[model samples]
Target: MSEFIEWGALGQVVVAGLIIGAGIPALFALGLRLLAGTTTQPQRAASGTRRAADGGVPAGPVAIARPTPARLVGAIACMGVVVGAIAFGLVFLVSGGH
Candidate 1:
């Protein structure tokens, strides 16, 4: 046996740390991205009037963005994973996994 290090254990720790530390943030960001996708299309003015010769900004009601069902599902799924990971960590800490 090596005096200062066990390569197998060290490797496991490194891999686990990478996954838990980096992966959680990545997942959370993914969730936010999924949830925040714009689903609104540019809308024309409700009135039939067209823009003037200057061609300035059209006078119209603001377009409102709503989340698509798929995006909502994806975001919920990603957030669920993040929340589950947090819950698992808390449980692990309470159970002396440290």
Candidate 2:
């Protein structure tokens, strides 16, 4: 009698699904995080202007961030992987990988 379960194919499918489903999102999130970099202290106005609203809350300082070249490259790489995965998916679908 033939085996009912194709363990090898099932495993491959599960692994591929896990990698494509989880890894892609993780890479995208990593790219965003790397691009965003770390935030420094809030920036103060150059003119040294501070305004108080009618609600009595003073205006807060603006935020500033700068990403290093390495970080930028890493971010680009991660995003590239994500885009490539998407392209591969499109091609796979078009080629009837379904």
Candidate 3:
């Protein structure tokens, strides 16, 4: 049985499993805590102009900033490349490759 089992592969698998299984939940919980305030009720307008009964804003159009899909994709691709490069370097170092 020992002859059939590759310890390096087994260690990699275990490390990968721990990183994904444990890291994901921790990151998710952290993100949830960071965004917890967004779900709260909106604060009442201070001394600003009162809204009409129709609830229409008298101000000009509100500017809304949104992340574009292309930018998001680019960011993700960049991160993937960075992670891949780091992993490759780590693997090379672990395997004693100069």
Candidate 4:
């Protein structure tokens, strides 16, 4: 029975499964986090804007600051990798996994 099982192939399958299953979602989440950056008070709020009420209420709408150039680039790269991986999988399936 041991002779019939290909350990090398099994190992490869396990590694691939872990990467495609866990790695892709991790990268995607990272990309989303980088893209969102953070929310903060707007620069130079207009005088008309009322201040937040006492009790932790926000004075005005908080704005999400744009991601820095480096972070933006990193996010794009991560998303690109995810998309590429998905496309590759679809193509592979269509090609009969040859």
Instruction: Point to the candidate with the largest TM-score.
Output: 4
Which candidate leads the pack in lDDT? 4
Report every candidate's CA lDDT: 0.84, 0.83, 0.59, 0.85
Off by over 4 Å in 2: 43-58
lDDT of 3 at 73: 56
Mind giving the per-residue lDDT tens digits that candidate 3 earns over 1-98? 48999999999999988866776555555544433332333345556654686384443334434445655555555555556656886899999996
- Candidate 1 per-residue lDDT, tens place, 1-98, comes to 79899999999999999999999999999999888857454566667565686375456555657678998999999999999999999999999997
CA RMSD, predictions in order: 4.5, 4.1, 10.6, 3.7
Model 2 agreement with the true structure over 23-81: per-residue lDDT tens digits = 99999999999999576655555663556552443356545568999999999999999
List of clashing residue pairs for candidate 4? 52-59
**TM, every model:** 0.70, 0.75, 0.36, 0.76
Q: Who is ahead in lDDT, 3 or 4?
A: 4
Which scores better on lDDT, 1 or 4?
Answer: 4
Over 4 Å off in model 1, which ranges? 39-64
Q: RMSD (Cα, Å) of candidate 3? A: 10.6
Off by over 4 Å in 4: 1-5, 41-54
Residue 93 in candidate 2, Cα distance off native in Å: 1.2
